[model samples]
Target: MKGTMVALGGGGFSMSEDGASALDDYILAMTKRPRPRICFIPTASGDADTYSERFEAAFRDRADTSVLSLFCHEPWGYSDPAMLLEQDVIYVGGGSTANLLAIWRLHGLPEMLEKALDSGTVLAGISAGMNCWFESSSTDSYGPLAPLDDGLGLIPGSACPHYLSEPRRRESYQHWVATGALADGFAVDDYAAVVWRDGAFVEAVAEQRDRPVFWVERTADGVVEREIPVRLLGQ
Candidate 1:
């Protein structure tokens, strides 16, 4: 069973004005099931209630939506890491990438996620969620935008979310890769998502036409940024 992943730079239910989006639908469609079971992990946002509520309201009608809160005062939804394997899609919410990783590690989630992936669960996330899947990423988790080398390493190279929406993300990421501080990788604009199947990049998709994805690489001349062609969703 090949693993699948959808890393969104930004703009999903969490960012959408209506708490619903074509990109969210695109993620559900990846399961190829009549009604996929999707679990939202909001650890990055410290399991924010509003975030989870938005997720439920957005996906409840279309998919079997559930929230797995690791920080709840009492047991909330599915607490066992093994339960994740039953999900058709595991969607992670955005917040502090650094905190998310630290908490997930303490709960032994990284290993379970790998097992779930190997068993064909589609792992998807936005912003911090997107950043956690790569070897390194440009993040604002610690304050100002900076490079973070510790990630789940599910995908090779590095990644930067909000490439276009966030100020300095593009220039800073490019500088890091160019200076050998980070590996060559991808950067995604708000509303854009990059797909990977079996740990290899498949394509890019976006909820809006103006949003794009890019491949940032280091060269002797410095850094090269190339805009990747994106398929506009809901067309």
Candidate 2:
């Protein structure tokens, strides 16, 4: 089955007291399944219990929620990694993109997640989670903001999250792409997400007010950018 993947620039049900339900709701709708099984993969934050708890509390009523804690070595009742296939959606939490990829490799989760996605699981995440699906991304994982061109390659090109919220993120991503250090690709501000359905670009959606989703590329003149109009949920 052709699967869907939604990469969030930032903001999610797990991140705020007011709770951004738009993105979370859109993610659930993408499952196209009644009472979808949603699993939270919090490896980025080193599988922090607080992050997992936030996910559970936020999604408890929306879907059958569970946490996959790789650091704790707890399987969350499933004996094998293959059980990931049973999930309808896997939501990755934000943190260090480099570290998250390392741990996932160590646990052999990359292959498993690939399989899950191929079998129709909607793979989605925020920040680092957003950055991991592409060929590369701009990240703060290694102290100073830098380019991480070694991603899972599930999607072509690069990605940048918190594009507007963080002052350095915009310039760093643009500069990296301009210098050929990072591939030209998409970048979304916090609370915005770019959605893909059946491997095709769908639309940019936002939980808060409409924010621009940028397509950045190098040109003969210089680095160029075009804003992709966003559709705010509930508008």
Candidate 3:
């Protein structure tokens, strides 16, 4: 069976002031189980305590939540990589994409995550979390926006998050694709997310109606960006 993934451009619990969002609720609802086992992987943020704490607080009443911290190895964190397989949803946090990839590779998390996905664990994340699954992505991990081709490749092509909220993201990504620096890919504005099942895009969703998602591709003339219709959540 194919796995399910929710890749958010932004606007999840982390970005929300109250640590709640329609996007997050949508993710939880995907599990189709009361009190789904949810694990927060904060490797991207260096396993920051606040991030985990916020995650726990956000999902506390809705799901069985635990955090997997790679830096401090807290008692509540998932130490055994195999434990990830038991989660109903593995939610990754946003941070330095490059560093997240490095640490995850060192800990053999890539393999473990694949296993978790195969076991029907819903994979979800924002920003770097969203970028990791694609073959390439536009990221600020290197201090400046650049193309990162070394991604998990769970999804084909490339991706760019914070497309609308971040300055120059759209232009830079379009230039990269047009110049053959990055593969044809999707770009999502903050407050928007794309859903995939069996590695194929199922739909685009958003917490805000104004935010949008785009499919960017290199054409003979130049780069073309087609806006993907978004389903506004909580409607």
Candidate 4:
């Protein structure tokens, strides 16, 4: 079953109320099928118990959503599309960016992921999942898994999450521009999300403005910051 990919600005496993669209949209899209196979991928890290727990909590028991935990650490998360072809949604959990990318490549998951998504298999990622889809990643992901020199390019720009959740995140985001690392990026706060539709940044949804998301572009000199408005409630 082919579907769309929804890359969220925040991790939905824990704080799930806001990003329900990622799941709901997938569910609603399957019109002619009994239900699409829904799998939650946690392989970016090795914590199966916690990953499964969070996945179950976010969705509880649903006839349509089956709880499947995938760990990229096993060196086969990316290589096994046969295990994923029946899945309607591949929801990636957050973890170390470098480790996530490494495992995906080691298991040959990036190419598989791209094929799955291209065929209409819905791909939804949070945090590390979101980071892996873009053309590049932030240095922030370096702390946990080492910065990824390569990434799966479902998205054409860089992805930076936990925007206002951290102290001096503006400084951190700006540093990318100052140092000429990645030019265009989407900086999403913990409560926000940036949706890509037909290969473009289409929607930005948030819960507050204090922690808003950003869309950046690179120029010859430095990166230019553009504060994209999010349709957050009461903002």
Give stretches of model 1 more than 4 Å off: 73-78
Question: Order of candidates by TM-score, top first?
Answer: 3, 1, 2, 4
How far is 173's C-alpha from truth in model 2 (Å)?
0.8
Candidates' RMSD to native: 1.4, 1.8, 1.2, 4.4
- What's the CA error at residue 197 for candidate 1, in Å? 0.4
A best-first ranking of the candidates according to their lDDT comes to 3, 1, 2, 4
The alpha-carbon deviation from the true structure for residue 173 of candidate 4, after best TM-score superposition, in angstroms, is: 2.0
The parts of candidate 2 lying over 4 Å away from their true place are 73-79
Better of 2 and 3 by TM-score: 3
The candidate, 3 or 4, that scores higher on lDDT is 3
Global lDDT scores for all candidate models: 0.92, 0.87, 0.92, 0.63
Compose the digit string of candidate 1's lDDT tens values, residues 42-108. Answer: 9999898878888989999989987888886233654887889899999999999999999999999
Give the Cα error of residue 215 in candidate 2, in Å: 0.5
Candidate 1, residue 163: Cα displacement in angstroms equals 0.4
Better of 1 and 4 by TM-score: 1
The candidate that achieves the highest TM-score relative to the unseen native structure:
3
| Candidate with maximal lDDT | 3
lDDT-better candidate, 1 vs 3: 3
Alpha-carbon TM-score of each model against the true structure: 0.97, 0.95, 0.97, 0.78
Clashing pairs in 2: none
Model 2 Cα displacement at 22 (Å)?
Answer: 0.7
State the lDDT of candidate 3 residue by residue for 5-113, as single tens digits. 9999998999999987999999989889989999999999889888889999999999998888778666664587777999999999999999999999988999999
